[model samples]
Target chain A: MKQSGTIVEKQYFTYGAAPDRLQLESGAVLGPVTIAYETFGTLNRDRDNVILIAHAFSGDSHVAGHYPTDREGDKPGWWDFMVGPGKGIDTDKYFVICPNILGSCMGSTGPKSINPETQKPYGLDFPMMTIGDMVTTQKALLDHLGISELRAVVGGSVGGMQVLEWCVRFPEMIRSAVPIATTMRHSALAIAFNEIARQSIMADPKWNNGDYYGGDFPRMGLAVARMVGHVTYLSDEAMRRKFGRRLQDKEAFSFGFFDGDFQVESYLRYQGSKFVDRFDANSLLYITKAADYFDVVDRVTASGPLKGGDLQKVKYLVISYSSDWLYPTYQAKELVQALKRTGQDVSFCEIEADCGHDAFLIPDERLTTLVKGFIDGVG
Target chain B: MKQSGTIVEKQYFTYGAAPDRLQLESGAVLGPVTIAYETFGTLNRDRDNVILIAHAFSGDSHVAGHYPTDREGDKPGWWDFMVGPGKGIDTDKYFVICPNILGSCMGSTGPKSINPETQKPYGLDFPMMTIGDMVTTQKALLDHLGISELRAVVGGSVGGMQVLEWCVRFPEMIRSAVPIATTMRHSALAIAFNEIARQSIMADPKWNNGDYYGGDFPRMGLAVARMVGHVTYLSDEAMRRKFGRRLQDKEAFSFGFFDGDFQVESYLRYQGSKFVDRFDANSLLYITKAADYFDVVDRVTASGPLKGGDLQKVKYLVISYSSDWLYPTYQAKELVQALKRTGQDVSFCEIEADCGHDAFLIPDERLTTLVKGFIDGVG
Candidate 1:
């Protein structure tokens, strides 16, 4: 995994006997696909000191310290603080592993991955994937890494969905589980936000039915989609406090309407433009659909409504932020309450924060202390 | 002077001693402006029964009832309830005159109107206008209509700003005044919304620096701008109630992001698309800027704040909607409280409604009843 100058390690593995076709919950079958992954910390002999972090949409396995060759501008990793030495999770003490989920553009088998039989990128013809399929793929990756158990499984938002998946799919595998700012079932409002973002991407004429690999990308629609998503990520109060009605340059109003007068407008435009530079539009659609399909309790209690679920083997830790409307604290409370009714060890905390849905990404001393204390208590 | 189809008798007049040169508050002048108006009912012998209804940003003299040549889809006017036969300010009694405000495309001499000197659209060369200049133009129109005294000057939002202006600039002319759901000064958030909308319009490449006339109009930018404004016109709860997570055509998710999935996205896109067909981009820019500059109290209110003097001669009524964030109820309360402080007869009511800023347009019996009772009580 070590290299000079922006090292992006790409490794591959074949999981299970390649079936003629593996059917997903959505009834789409994918066959004989290779999965890509990149490893970080070394696994201990006991394999019990492992932390499994799941990637959200548009994220990859780069969850901590930069590759030796990474350039200055490229972000080292999404969760640099928690995984670093002496930080929240502490890389020195615990082995950390993050897998780029299935149906993602980041070092994983996705729509862009070549179909072995056709030897071409599986564009729209790529099999549709459910959140369960994504979790199954992660399970395969963990098996390949020779890790049968984990100290903890931790994630936020869509990442939180994966953490829940790990618990239900293999309850004994996880000693502790932390699902932050996530929902048991996607709300109508949440679905609407995702649907709008998806439509914005799809409406772009440049999309060319998801096969525009060599041509100009659907930048405008993708930018609009990102703009919509970014709005949900930050609170209105946060935006007002940060930018307000401050102007870009001018004082008096320009009679002609051809300039940015307010700082908020400029900030949104900047956010949109920069997002299209790094993210793939198709990947956004696929990942959002995966998130939209996530609902773990329905499977666990299909016959009858579950007052609680079996969490005796798993010490559950749920966290939420006050201002996060995207996945509010109430959703986190539901999970904790469900586990409580099941007579399981569960701790839920709602943190006061102004960052909205993205609060989980920001370093809060209180949040870090809670996470560290909860994980240590589990041991 | 009433016809079956005609709402009111159309009237026009020329004033401002330097009739060829219209002087502005900023000491600027444009030549030979025309004002179009319509008067309902009849003026009293004392010329004191006249009530002036100030128009909003894009509104015209056609504030109530059917226009002489109004087509099927076109509304009678924005506020038909508050001014009609047996209505709020009953046309059978009190004389109500609503004039097309200056700097508007509708009948008023604006950027779209031909410049007498150049025989071309004023466009970008038109001098910037303030709220004061608009009130001044209205005064001249009132004088020509042979009304020395106004029983009341009533308005909401930008119209409310004009009502305040009339009270300040010509206190002797108004007997009673109503300024509803408006503020004497714009908040930073209000300014941010307007500025972002302007930026959305200018961002479109086809704007051609506001000279796209007789060519492909800047429809994309204009549509985007309208979409932004439409969002402000609606409360979050209203949007959620109307469009929520309802899917457009499909039941299951379309993994590809090309088509509209959610009803809200489709609704917003439809609203945006239809807006461009009816509205002129340049007019939108001008009108929004006018609204942004409409502060009754000057920005730097150091010692004595700007106030409408001698409200003893005027009775004031203010109305606001519960969910109207664009022009909140607090603003109407402020206007009413200010008038009361000056020992004026004032009444204020906040309507309970979910539609937000555009609630005034909806057919609400309470609004009609309250307005009618108030007008009759004043009479």
Candidate 2:
């Protein structure tokens, strides 16, 4: 799936045992995992400046630059602003690697992938994945790169969950970590959003028990789910500011159920429709489930009963956006509070950005400065 | 349709010629309409004290008391708190009339009703309806009751739109109007919410173009739609306050997508599934479309061509909730501004309530007191 692109390289790698031996939390193991990754900048002499970037829902390994084999009208990848040289993540200073998560459709092993045993798509039968499972696979990738330690780990939203997971699951692997606009645990409200999206997919008759590979697929359900998730990604103020009472194309109502009467309707429809062409509904289900079930506190708490995790050994910089209602500032505060309780060396900054949860993906001078300064201080 | 054992007597009247024909803004006449109304208190000789209560989405004519005829576990009525004796509307002083709107399945001539011309349910073939059409039918119902004027017309959310429509459609018919937790128009953001809900319904394969009457009837779509609407009804703060990150039953992740991993998920699913048993998907589509097309600002700014409608002359009491992101206080302010600009007698009230868009249905003493005092002052 490598596309020759300017400025960044998109690539893939194999890690661990074959698909039949990948291990599970419940003492089950099945493997042969493939990872789709995009790399920016060059690794240092000691290969110690590596920074892992995890993609969120609907995200892929194409974190920055134009996909080498670009098509007209292709979307600039979700985090393109942050990964380019001289940008927030600064590919010029850091070796950045963004990998499509285990349960995604961006060249990763998901429901859309073929089942070696049956010679058909895995579909619903694909083993349910957890955030820990995703991190464990990333560890395998790091080992393949001969990287014994990472300078830092950074992510936002579900990606932020992965950053936190890295801090817990592989504390020694990361010197500093930044989790932006993310929750410590998936809130009931958060899980509700994912469940509704999953229900929307399964409800589609064309989903065909996740076996609609050669047909129309459940594009409508997938679109609707994306629309729902899109609403969460935006702040109410941002929505109102952008398209309050704005008409679509006409001055008056058509008085019929058709294209759109309001600008937001047209915007959402476009979002939903465009999403289906590049996304798999089953991957949406699997990835959201993975994020919903992710909890760093619970995992660490279980190991040493929530008392023995020494966070002082781990330097943390938590970033939250003021207008991000999906994962509000208080959730970040909660994370800070729990980390403090665990006696961690933690610093928190809530940036007053109005871009909502997507702020983490955009280029904010303040954020860029803070991140660069924090990384320098940790080094 | 009138088998009732409640505080008030049920009245059924055939108003339009077609089962669901209510006149639209295009000078189109809709007929054969049926209205189910519950009138509380006497009409009085002059019928000046009649107050019309427009129910919100999924509401019925039963405004108060448990109907002996109602099935077990069903609600008595949505607005029982505001319409009973000494309540906000004050049944002791005002003759309150709550009517099931024309395009609803609750004893009104909707898609579920038999089209006398074809002797089968109208289903998708039913003429499309607008908020104006609903108001027109309600006016006819009032005419059948021999009420020459109403002291007030009151509603919340979608019902609030009806209240505004009553004033705009028949300014002379209503002396004062209270529209709560609603806007002068469905904002682009609001329309987006409704659009996703409608898309959720239409996407369900079992919908089969709204002809699924006897067999499987898009329950999944309806449920998903309701779930989408439910999220909008509650504020982020409310959800955080109510559910937080609380797990449903087990303290740990189930690692499977069975059900009820979180409390909010269970609550939303419950809200959705419970709604499917009584509501019609076609009605959902029609009512949402009506809401999306409604805009009082269009009436006030006819020269500017906002929506192009005749602005009715009536006093307005526009009420909004502080925590209502769905229809925030800013929207209500827009309504008041439009009415003020049009030289209409409009008073605005911003009620401080923790409840989101559903605040009007809940008994906030401040809101109820403000409403009662305003109604009395207008009278």
lDDT of each: 0.72, 0.80
C-alpha lDDT (0 to 100) for residue A282 of candidate 2: 89
> Compared with the true structure, what per-residue lDDT tens digits does model 1 show for residues B130-248?
77788888888877767788877888778888888787677667767777667775654566566545655564556666767677877766666666666667776677688755678
DockQ of each: 0.26, 0.59
Q: All candidates' TM-scores?
A: 0.80, 0.91
Classified by CAPRI criteria, candidate 2 counts as medium
For B226-260, candidate 2 gives per-residue lDDT tens digits of 99888888877778788876778878766666666
Checking candidate 1 for backbone clashes, the offending pairs are A5-A69, A6-A69, A202-B257, A202-B258
User: Per-residue lDDT tens digits of candidate 1, residues A1-379?
Assistant: 3423224355676654356556677777787656666655567788888888887777778877666666666666777766667778877678777788787877677877777767887767777787788788778777878889988999988888988888777777879899988877676557656765665566555766777776788787677767667767876556658765566777855544546555665676788789888777877888887787677765433311232343345788899999887787877887777666556678888999887888888878988898888877777
- Judged by DockQ cut-offs, the docking class of candidate 1 is acceptable
